[model samples]
Target: MKRLRISLTAQIFLGLILGAAFGCFFPDFGSQLKPLGDAFIRMIKMIVVPLIFSTLVIGIAGTGDFKKLGRLGGKAIIWFEVASALALIVGLVVVNVLQPGVGVSLPAIGAAAGANAAATAQSFSISMHLLNIIPANIVEACVKSDMLQIIFFTCFFGVALAHIGEKGKIVVECCRGIAEAMFKVTHIQMNICCAKLFENYK
Candidate 1:
C-alpha cells in the first residue's frame, strides 16, 4: 500500500476546515488559540519591510536605464491605483447589496475609543500622508514597518546607485544578495506559520 503525502496547500485547506470546526464547537478553546495566530501574523509582518526593500532596490538598480525605470514606476503606480479603486468599488457594492450588518445586533464596547478613532481619521490630511512617505529616520521607519517610507527610501537609494554607473556595481550586487537571503527567510517564515497552524489543530 502506498502512503499518502499531503501537499502544503492541502494541509492549509485541512487546517482551515478543522479550525472552523473547532471554533464552532469549542468557542472558548478556539479563542485561547488566538496567541498562536497572533504570533504567526507578527512573524509574517516582520518579513515584509526588509524583503520588499531588498527586492525593490535590486529591481531598480538592475534596470540600468533611468528613463525605463521612470516609465516602469509610472505604470506601476497607475496599475496600483486602478486596481485599488476597482477593489474598493467591488467591496462597497457587495456590502451595500448584502447589507451584512442588517440583522446583527452587537453591543458598543468603547464609545470613547470609537470617538477618538473617528476624530483621528477625520483629521488625517493628504499633506500628512505625503510627509509620512519621507522617512525622518530610516531605522525608525523599519521598526514601525512604514512600507511607503521604506519604499521611498529604497527607490531613491536604487536610483542613486544606478546613476553612479560601474562604481555602484558592488552595492547593486550586495542588494541582490540581500534580496535572495530575504526570499529564503520569507519561505522559512511561511513554513513556520504553517507548522504553527497545524500545531493549533492538535
Candidate 2:
C-alpha cells in the first residue's frame, strides 16, 4: 500500500483510467476539466524566464574567458543554421516525393473568409516570431518571458562581470550560488507538479 501510494507511474495510470471513464460517462463534466490542464501548462511556462536567466548568467560568469564564450556562441549559431537548413531541405524533399496535397480536394481558395483570416493570423504569428528576437525594452523582454533575450542579456552581463577583476569574482560566486539554489528549487517543484498531476489522474 505504501508502495502504491508513492508510485507516480501507478498514480498516473489510475488517473488516466478514471479520467477516461469519466469522459465516457460524462462528456460535459470532462470538458469542464480543461482548465486544470491549461493551469498546469501555465504554471510550467511561468518558471521559464527566471530559470533561463539564472542558469545563463551563472554559466557565462563562471566561464572566465570571453574568447571561449564567443567561440561557443559562434559554433552554436552555425550548428543551428546547418540543422535548420537540413530539416527544411529534408521536409521539402519528402513533401515533393509524397505529394500528399496533390490529389486531395482542398477547400476553394477564395470561398472562406474565416480561412483567409486564419492564414493572415498565421502569417502575423510568423512575422511576430521573427521580430520578437529584437528586444523592445529590457524589462518588457523579461516580463514577456522572452528566453532568447534573457539569455543574451545574462550572457553579456556575465562576460562583463568576468572582466571586472576582483569585484567580478565576488559577483560570479553569488550568481553561481543563486543558480544552484534556483535549480534545486526548480527540480523540487517539478517533482511536486508531477506528483500532483499523477494524483489527479489516479
Best by lDDT: 1
Task: Output the lDDT of residue 187, model 1.
Answer: 71
Residue 35, candidate 2: Cα error in Å is: 2.9
Q: Quote the lDDT for 21 in model 2.
A: 90
Give all candidates' CA lDDT scores.
0.84, 0.74
Candidate 1 C-alpha error for residue 65, in Å: 1.3
* Candidate 2 residue spans exceeding 4 A from truth: 1-30, 78-136, 196-202
Worst 10 residues of 2 by lDDT: 193-202
Candidate 1 per-residue C-alpha lDDT over 1-202 given as tens digits, one digit per residue, 9 for 90 to 100: 4544655677677778888998999999999999997887888787788788878877898899888988998999999999999999999999999888897889886999899999999999999989879999999999998888899999899889888999888988887888888878867766665644333221
- Segments of candidate 1 deviating more than 4 angstroms: 1-4, 103-123, 195-202
Against the hidden reference, what TM-scores do the models get? 0.78, 0.58
State each candidate's clash count: 0, 2
